[model samples]
Target: MADIAGRAGVSLATVDRVINRRKGVKERTRQQVLEAALALGFLGADEMARFRDRREANIVFLLPAGTNPYLRDLGDHLRQRVALREEGSPKVRCFFIEGFNAPALAEAIRRNADWADGIAFFAIDHPAVREAVAEVAANGVRLVTVVSDLGHSGCDAYVGHENRSVGRTAGLLIGRFIAERQGAVALVAGSRHYRAHSEREAGFLSIQEEMFPHLRLVGMREGHDDSGQNYRHTIALLDQNPDLRGIYNVGGSSGGVARALAERGRSDVAFIGHGLTKDTRNALVEGVMDAVFHTDPETLIDRAIGAICQPERQVLPMKLEIVFRENLP
Candidate 1:
């Protein structure tokens, strides 16, 4: 204890509290002491035995199911990371919810509350979802919102990028890329139910109104994060507004939008979308898509695990990355 305290620049009492999992110690202090103890080999055989004897934590991840490459890749990456964990680590299980509607997501949370020590999900900001999150939290399960957030829903923390900033960046890029600033620009989203999507749309519109006054937002549509739906919507938007100068896709189905633009021989139109998956990468390479905004899924999962296991710890905002054809890795 003395060695740990000295190494961490804290008192012996603080080290004692952290090792015993006692409350009142600030999370940063606790982490410092824990790291010091591990580095100095202060946790002896007895301490290791005590830790091993404690009840195993069960963390459940509720992810969306579909052909959306980003979500699919996130789920796959998390599963692989959890599977590769060494023995004695917490058990991590992932469940995919179909359609990603509020009711289905709510029910999944309710059902998992009985078994999950921690719950993480891509949230829809709806009353039913909030109620479900509150109920799970009341049952003593730690909640972490990932990718999308449910505001004030008793969640312990959020682990994702600043979505509104991502939207504003997209809007600014599209505005600068468009040749004719006076023409109409279209916006496509997955669903208004997702706070991330709505926030992105709001940011995009705000920047367009403030900086690009001549660019008119002619149409907005929900693609449900489905490629087929996005393709259809893009086709309709082009048909209705033949003079459209740009398209901003604030959702997962950028491939569909790229396909639609290609079919209509409208590759000249400024196209901006989210995610850097194979589909979007190919589109960017083929000059069918302009820019893509993305973040590392592996980093997201790491922060989510920290948020779940150490409920008192704070999760820092994820960095948003923009990928272009010239910077393909």
Candidate 2:
């Protein structure tokens, strides 16, 4: 047992757990122990091979299917990373359902509960989704909410920023960039159902009312995180409010906002939004977008995986990064 432990780079207790088929040992460590035992002639080759067939843990991601560049990139990055791993590690599967479909999202959560040991996804704050999250967490499944958080829904961790903070930052930047010019500022959101967007909208509104009393806040519009809808909204907002001085998008519709600004020849208007995507990056470089914010996809995924592995560990909110034309990394 000690020889196997030394060979496997594990403690004697772990070797004992693997040898006795105990529940606590991780799959990779268990496999290593079995390999060492086989090398030492303590177990038959066939036996070790048979035991190796068992998988460690199953993790599933239920991401929203959307045209939002940031979310699409995040999902793609996650899929690519998970595909390159060895056989014994946790197997991650990603499924895309329609964005903001409460029933479909709830159903997906419940459907995967029996099989997935850990589940990560974009969260909606609807009651049905909350109930489903509660059920899964109660069953000991680790749950992490990615970009849009629903931590109050009993999710184990949230893998995104404190959205209200992001909003306040946006508000501050937009307000200062326009620099005491008195005109209407408009807000565009991805969806009303997403709590993150709502929180961001609230934060921006609060700061705008508190500090920028000189500016009038036009009513907000929901863009559904779709570029086309966002473009239309921005065009109308600009046409109606010829005095519009700035725009704050509480969602990922930076592309639409930029396009609208260009079409209306309002590039001089201060625009602030989320995601440091190609469109937004170019906008920043060209001075079309005043500022944009983002979080690293790899960091978010790593934080979520840690929470999933430990189950009870506390996962901190992922950091938010603000980008400007001068600091375009």
Candidate 3:
């Protein structure tokens, strides 16, 4: 910082304000100081803030937008932790951006490259997104994939379940719930773009084929992680297949599925899916849905933050929680 102040021909206080993103630094001066820091391999306000040197740790969370239950849970828990600042806090700052628009997300990642010490994204598997992750890695940012994954992208750690195994578990759970019933079972997924959802569907199909040969997997509907669309498509499919005995939702839009089921007065169908949000808990208690494959998003975020703060420590692997009416906690 002394070197930066001297090199920029600015006072130490001026350099501090600009580098810390504190108010009162002129925009031009801020830019100049930032450019000087970048040029000199000096940390930005966000990175330096993580230090008791009053360093701020800027960690960006890139995820799909909308009323996504899982991301909402994750964001809420992380923010609560940020508020408490009681344990392992690192001058935290977060950015929530839409997970689609690969280029836009990539650009955001790149823009924060110098400012952020680490990044956790629900990665989309496009080349641009991978390249952006790579760029962050190259910039020496601690990188992690959360919820959905970017498996081959050289992420420092993944803070979600073994996706394929969880999917297989979802499949087996759904397969059994519909085994004695008649008619083909339908599956609704958040998006084919997400590795997690796809793996869940695969696990589901594998188990369904192996155990419930009588129950057919009719096909899958793509809901694009939108609640309205998930509801609409679920309703449409229910209408088309009156004999549809089951529905397995493998992503955050499980609430929409419950709504569609309730609207059609066919909550009798064995509807089971993922996530244990308030909606799913209510549905399970009312017997509207059978069960949910739950994950503790709060723990996921905590471990993620820990991984960022101490990359050398082995953050524990996430567990797949199965939530039933009797065990909805």
The TM-scores of all predictions, comma-separated, are 0.83, 0.82, 0.80
lDDT rank order: 1, 2, 3
Candidate 2, residues 18-130, lDDT tens digits: the string is 77755445455667889899999999978877776654777888888888898888888878978797867777888888988998999999999777878888888899999
lDDT of 3 by residue, 104-204 (tens): 77887787766667877777778888998876785457788877777789788888888777867766776676668768788898777788888888888
Which portions of model 1 show Cα errors greater than 4 Å?
1-56
Clashing pairs in 1: none
Q: Report model 3's TM-score to 2 decimal places.
A: 0.80
lDDT of 1 by residue, 1-329 (tens): 89889999988877876788653354466668777887899876677556435455678899888878899889889789687977777788899997557899999999987677788899988999999988777655788999899877889899987888888998899989984457899999998888999999999999999889898897579998999999999999999998888999988979999999999999888999888898899999989999998878888888888897777666888888888999987
TM-score-superior candidate, 1 or 2: 1
Greater-TM-score candidate between 1 and 3:
1
Off by over 4 Å in 3: 1-57, 86-88
Candidate of highest TM-score:
1
Clashes of each: 0, 0, 7
lDDT scores of the candidates, listed in order:
0.85, 0.84, 0.76
Query: Candidate 2: misplaced stretches above 4 Å?
Result: 1-55
Return whichever of 1 and 3 wins on lDDT: 1
